[model samples]
Target: MEHSHTADWWKKSTVYQVYPKSFKDTTGSGEGDIRGLIEKLDYLQGLGIDIIWLQPVYVSPQNDNGYDVADYCEINPEYGTMADFDELAAEVRRRNMHLMLDIVVNHSSTEHRWFQEAKQSRNNPYRDYYIWKDPAPGGGVPNNWQSKFGGPAWQYDEATGQYFLTLFDKTQADLNWENPAVREEVVKLMTFWAEKGVSGFRLDVINLISKDQNFPDDDGSARPGDGRKFYTDGPRVHEYMKELNRRIFKPYNLVTVGEMSSTSLENCILYSNPEQNELSMTFNFHHLKVDYPNGQKWELMPYDFEQLKSLLSRWQTGMQEGCGWNALFFNNHDQPRALSRFTDDSEYRVESAKLLATTLHGLQGTPYVFQGEEIGLPNPKWNGIEEMRDVESHNIYRILQEQGKSPEEAFNIIRERSRDNSRTPMLWDSTPNAGFTSGTPWIKVDERYPEINVERQLHDPDSVYHHYKKLIGLRKKHQILIDGTFVRLDEAHPQVFAYSRVKGQEAVVVVSNFSKEQTVFQFADAFAEEWLEAGPAELLAGNTKQVPPLWKEMALSPFASYMWLIRRK
Candidate 1:
């Protein structure tokens, strides 16, 4: 525990994630632009954001909301031009904050010139750029692999007589990483952005880039998309990553965080360990999977709290012990708003928001705050099927119906799990369009915008926004918060999640009530009486200013959280 994460830039810095299109719009275009981000620099800096990890703003077909990139070096017209991006990067630098761009190298939009040419003929030079295979024996698709979006992973091209792999959407053709030329091209694209002043890269679905050379069927899997097992941590993943590090990232001294979907702890260590020099950090999605039951994301199921605790503890301990860094996040452009997913967003919105912040930020990782998360935004009412825009949501709905479920059942499930829940326009004020745009927003602003908007909360000290600012400041001021060892407490408590970050004699115990009912946290015999000196612990932060006597136990109001500094003699 003596070794610390104090000196590293990411270890102590708070990163703010911006989902470009829905974040803010200035051109009456109903979409957020790079210029809009430039205008909001002061607002982001005021929130103590040391870095901004912008979601993909690259030129794309809008098939997956900027994820399916058609051009890597240019900015999307919806987001503005390359010159506008330059201005935004300069503004971020002027504010003393770093800019991290989303790098979508796992696949490219079919509209990309390379993919277009690859579809022309089997002998085409661009054919090897994508994963293409001959038809099966019976004149069907190339393999039994299923797409993450829906149906088959293979898309047939009439012109070429071969099926190309599209792990995500049919329009997104997977790249053949086994081809050294393809790898070199990807590195070139990334280098182009780095030379443009980008500080970091958030590699999208990074683990999926390396696939099993021998295409095989996921026969035993009940679901179709079980194909992930083949590519989760493939044969050449580490080799490819190491090469990428040596060629692209290490040269710029840039930080990189790979978004890993189905990665193992052992491999994660190799991917992010500082000694390995592969990545600065890796985003493990296991914590976010607690809500998926039987491995089905569309199923309506309550989050398994115990499963969540165990998974998080494993990652926290495994990564730290393995000399690897962790990237911690609750909400993202791809997930539902955390306030509504984990807590009662209606009644205890403020308290639960603060509690979640206290719990996640106190851990040993580089915390990422999704856009609007600081203001405690909740998922908008799942208006109707027409409002849903994501291909994944629509695909899941159809799949559920094919599995013998009623249309209502499928709609309800997709309503709760759709990416559109988080894609709603940001609520900046009580204005008609939440001040995001003078024109109509791409997605309707949440109706509660009047109550939870930023304009009103910016001046309120007790707002969720202010609470986050305090948490970020605490991490910067208290070195222990960034370098302490994690110790879980009240493991069996259904309503309270508690832990302590200890470093030598200095420690901070974090306690949060996860339920709506009042609860009491008693000092376990070993925690207070046996280990610490007999004295009052200094309160560092809490939703409620009042701290009850902790001689034996302390009462916690519904959703209340506390961070106490305990120094043992």
Candidate 2:
């Protein structure tokens, strides 16, 4: 459980995720690239961001928008050359910030040289690098595995007369980690990035790295295609992660976070145990799964505040001491905006957005701020399914159509839940293409850029941008906010979510209104006595409140939030 490195550094760090394709396009080639990100380092630094987690810029066929890697060692020509990445890494370091690169080792593009070699013949040396098997007696797949993108997970390779494993698209073949050679190659490839000055790696679908060797088929009663339980969080996952840490990450003092899907709390603690010498942290999907119908594929579900609060609290408490850090996020390259998903964005967008930010960032974990989130960006109102670019969105649309859902219904779901929601061009200014590019953007920019762009908000003191700035600064300036213990207050209050972070004598109480209507609540007697009237600095809202409570209850405006520093009476 003991960490060789200091914990304080990570406790106070704020990571910013940049989806390269949508961040900024400098080449005017309709895509954002390394050069474009390099140009924006100053702007990110100005926003008080401490680390940059750049999503995949590696060579890919773009089947899954860069998740399918063709070459781990080379940069995609469309993104830029290796020289540009080196410069970007150096530039970020110059600002005294860190950079984390996406490591997609779970799978590779079917067109990759290794896959191509494997496809030629079963006897090829490269054949073992991927999982391949002959068809069943019935001339069907080896198992009832389902691809995350939809359809069967096993893709038939006619030339070899076998099927290769692909948990995602057919173009992305899952790697066989049982092969020692593959593990060695992954370590070497990771070392290549470490040597290039990448501070860390955000491992992609890392839990899927070690699959169930038995390759069991889904039961007859299983859903159309649900094999995740069999392949996810497999037996050798921890062993593989530990070996990776010992061989590559530990030696370099690198920060590594695993993008683990279907991982339970037990697995999270095991994989991220500081003493396990594995990952620095592992992301939790419990909150994200709230909208999934019985974890079934393509089911309409709604976000639940109580479910989210329980998930966050569990992670915060479960990983309190020796357990590795938790990576906190609401929106990423694959998620819709937090405002739209977590709040009632239709009427209380700004208040709910800021309240959500406060509620999340105030928790005990490493917070990740996705681009445009600071300005309270909501999911774009895409007119039709044709306007979306994400493959998952397209696949879901087709699935909905087959399930008898109307085109309008399909498009509506896509608009509200598509990964494309996060990929919309950055709203830097009110100019053409949201100031992301002069030429046409690779994807359509959100229409609300004129009011939501960074340029306008940066100058306005009351803007969400400035609110985030203060939040970041508060975390940095106050130890209680950064490295304190969390205690949930008024757990049964449906309209209120409150918690206090205490470090010895220093305490900061944070309370948020989760509903659209005002709520009245009183502080715990112990906290009320020591409460200091630190006039509301407006962390997210302009709402103010008087401190101390004995005979009266404090009221919070609709979707309002408050944080106050309290000392011992």
Candidate 3:
């Protein structure tokens, strides 16, 4: 199917995600604030970023690191005041860059006014704003469902003697989408930001907004008994998304991406297909789970090369065939850094990081650059649980211990898979606190900041940051990168991830060696006869300074990556 979103600026743009807590701290508050981000607008623009995707800065009670928003309309004191936010929005526009806000409406922190008042009495007007149910006849939780973060999905309200659903942390009460009032509230909050010049909305766990009204128990089919099947891509999810688009996005002409949890490819296509009018793109975690043994995130294994290649190819082809868009990324606030997870941090950090950039950037999707990702940052080396501050990590660590894992064993897993791996402070310079804050940082900065800081990379032309910049720039220069039909090259190639994007006479070919050993790739019969003829092709980008010309048989060095643009002459 031919996609028609070519005219959309977002289609050709790159997004830079800034986790406010660890980005930078100008106020010595020990946490990053709006003003701190404002100070980095030039830095972002210099990196050729087209949009800035800022994580939630809404009022919260320090739960889920601001994902559990207590107030959607107000800026968190820890982040900054509304005035600071306004300055940020204005500064973003001044630089000709768009700002995308993270919208967390699936659940509200228990400290929110609606949830607080709802707890006051069952008859409170705000009671229906959240999901609540009567205790089971056996006087336990409402169902056998478990929270995504471990523990029962329902928390008994002592005052009301009823159970409330919390798909995540107990402090985060799932919003009741069955109530029109709640939906309206969400629209109002989004409109509030749109009115203030926010051009994009990154909806967190958006697919989970519509849950099954029946509140059924898990049948042991879904993994971990999370009851995700009942709510994930639920019966009314499409309707809810359509309603949201009609009320907020369509009117404002804003770009939107839905974070889909445990979602399927078919559901994602419907959610992001332009004709569906639901979302501009969707973020799915299937590829990121290649290392999850048996799809369990708490457990870890060496990433399956075959699975990673297959998943990427499937999503690329599936989304293209369905005219859907993807929000391409490897590292995000909730994920561990891709460098550490995919390649050896000691030997091939820079090359593999660039290899990953070229591999994903050449695909038909909008790429997102997590703050430290462009600088080739890897997972922090934590001494113990004390240095790791992620709430989920702490919870998982304790659970692993209860399951009979020794502290050392559990810590190793946590060290590798903890969300804190990506949440570490952005390394700006090698000075104290990695130049993130003058005061003691809320969390310890990664010890490798001295070598990986942006300052060091900025001056080096061969740095990973420059490689990302070149890859991003190519997206704008080559329309094939955005609108071309995706075709995976040598789908079963053991050590190399390769693909080609074709659009009429022009094609962008990308190849990356995912292994430390050298690998040779042979062009397919069709591609070799059509494009690999003895002709001149522009080498658009490569991880190494010296790259060989295109040929029928290509040899890729360890962690090597190259993107070539060819046209019928």
Candidate 4:
């Protein structure tokens, strides 16, 4: 497993994901822009971020919030111009940091040139660029595939008298990867950015590109169907990924991470394994779905802690054994702030935030910190459906009511589990509009911004922001943390989440109390005896004001977390 200069840097680096729309509004447009991000570069660098993973700022119809890219080569006028992007790339390099752009190649917005031309006529040269099929013998949709948002996955094009595949929104047409021209077009666009000095790419839904050409109908057994099985991690996904690597990634020495949706652990390993020449890392949503009762996202229930522990342990151990890398994250643009979902965010907001940080940063992967997560931003409070901006949340609210749920019942579920929760304006100060905008904001700022803004936390010594800073710095200070063997500690422990990362003689043990009450942590029998009787350990980072006793058996306060650097006797 030899490493190149580019390969070694990503392993030791931490990425900060910015949802450009809600990050900062510079022109009083109520939308974040490239200039606004430029103004905050110093703030991000102060937090010790190595790479800035900017979410889609490409030209789009905003159907899926920029996930449906209309033009891969042009910057959205809503965000800024191409010159602003060039300045951002140059500024990022000036600060000795890298910029990673989010790329959506799995599908293209209906307004994209290719899709527009394809819809003009069946014999159009660009028609083969997207997947289009004739009606089934029954004279309906080409297949029984269902849309992820709602309704049918295939949208009928009257002009062509055919239906096109769209697993997500109908406005987003799936690209035909079987066509070499389509694959070549993707490579060309990605290379365009690479030539502009972009260091990496966060590929969105990349696993679904090389879908089954057979276009088979799905059985009704799977919960998330109309036909995810046929497309997710499809037959030629690995082959396509390998080709991508050879075409651009390897030659340009760019860092790439694939956003895998409804994918398997085995597929992820092959997708990210260095030996496989596919990608640098992968993002899986298994652990995040612990609250999805019976794999249903709309329903609500207490998240299964045991299930969370098992899934994390499985991936940690499995990825480590397979020599594959993972992109570790919790809060993101598409999900609610994890603090609200995992623990008590009311009484112990700061403590629980730090605890979640320790739990993730100590794992074996490149940690991605979403905007405002560093300052302990929880989910926003919404009043009604009018305040909601996410299309998925609105669609689900209607579906819940269609399922016979009362208005109150449906809204309650949406309030708890809406993507809009994380899309609120980033709180920079305690001023009006949370200092995010001077004009009317696209979305309302959370009322709690006055208390949880970054200005207040910046001066506080014991703040979530500083905790994340120290954790990011620790990776550079300790080599063991970069490539340690992940060992789960006491999987049966009900109240605490713990693990150890060992490399040769040194190991870093991370212990976190996930419960509200104080708990005791006893070393599991599987732990090596040498570590228990080891010499005095150094406290690496922790959430508590005062350090706890360094011993095999110790008391852990509510939401208490600590990382200890140890050397086996």
Candidates in descending lDDT order: 4, 3, 1, 2
What is candidate 2's lDDT per residue for 110-150, written digit by digit as tens? 87999989988889999999999899989989998888887
Provide the clashing-pair count of each candidate structure: 0, 0, 0, 1
Q: Please write out the lDDT profile of model 3 over residues 1-569, one tens digit for every residue.
A: 11134436799999999999999999998899899999999999999998899998998997888889988899988888999999999999888889999999999999999999999999999999998899899888888899988989999999999999999998999999999999999999998999999998999999998888888888887555669889899989999999998988888888899999989999999999999989999999999999998888888799999998899889999999999999999989889889989886878888988888888898889999999989999888889999988889999999999999999999999999998988888999999899999999998898888888999999999999998989888888888888999888876888988888999988888888888998898889888888877357899889886797788898888999998988888
Write the residue-wise lDDT of candidate 4 on 1-569 in tens digits: 12235554799999999999999999999999999999999999999999999999999999999999999999999999999999999999889889999999999999999999999999999999999999999898988889888899999988889999998999999999999999999999988999998999999999999878888878777854568888989999999999999999988888899999988899988988899999999999999999998888888999999999899999998998898999999989989999999987889999999999999999999999999899998888778999999999888888899999999999999999999989999999999999999999999999998899989988998999999999999988898888999988866799988889988988899999999998998986546466856666889989987777767788989999999998866
Off by over 4 Å in 1: 1-7, 221-225, 530-535
Q: Which stretches of candidate 4 lie above 4 Å from their native place?
A: 1-6, 525-528
| Global lDDT scores for all candidate models | 0.85, 0.82, 0.90, 0.91
Q: Model 2 Cα RMSD, Å?
A: 3.0
Better of 2 and 3 by TM-score: 3
Tens digits of per-residue lDDT, candidate 1, 437-475, equal 999787778888889898999989989999899889988
Global local distance difference test of model 2:
0.82
Model 2 bad stretches (over 4 Å)? 1-8, 220-225, 524-552
List candidate 3 segments past 4 Å from native. 1-7
